[model samples]
Target: MIYKRLEFKNMAGQKVKITEIPVLDSRNPHYFLVHARLQALAAFIYNNPDSKTSYSFHDYLKRKMKWSDFIQLYRTEQYSHNA
Candidate 1:
């Protein structure tokens, strides 16, 4: 859940008011169901660090994803579709 509030401030020599931003809590329902899998995801991350996977993302993607995936992700900001 998030709480919204209003705030007042002085900007450019003028007094201005703005709506306060909402706070995001990881414990929320959606977050808990989705993004809150931090531990599992962390394990997954640690399980497949540096684009390397032990058992292979498939068998093909592993060997290919190892260094090449890192390269693709780093240079192109995307995973190789082939991998």
Candidate 2:
């Protein structure tokens, strides 16, 4: 998600900078809106229940998403959750 209070370690075991994390959508390049990030993160978590903090949604969706469609998907999910 937005990782509001993040403090994760990177692959090299160095502390990760919050800026290194992206929201997995090219349209929302830098980061997704808080709520959208939350929903996407939730779906990812559900699908990968056994995983720990080893992967990011950005990593998973980078190739699966087109910039425009990704935005639409995220917005739709957000609306449904809050609707």
- In the range 1-83, model 2's lDDT, one tens digit per residue, is 43333454544444432232434445554345534654565554544444265445544445456777656545534455566
Per-residue accuracy of model 1 over 1-83 as CA lDDT, tens digit each: 23343322222223222222224465643333222333343344444434222222223222433565434323433458867
What is the lDDT for 38 in model 2?
Answer: 47
**Residue 63 in model 2: shift from native, Å?**
3.1
- Weakest lDDT window of 10 consecutive positions for candidate 1: 51-60
Q: Rate the local accuracy (lDDT) of all candidates.
A: 0.34, 0.47
Clash count of each predicted structure: 0, 1
Please list the residue runs of candidate 2 whose C-alpha ends up more than 4 Å from where it truly belongs after superposition.
1-19, 23-38, 46-48, 67-83
Clashing pairs in 1: none
Give candidate 1 regions above 4 Å deviation.
1-23, 52-83
Pairs of residues clashing in candidate 2: 24-58
The CA lDDT at 9 in model 1 is: 28
Candidate of highest lDDT: 2
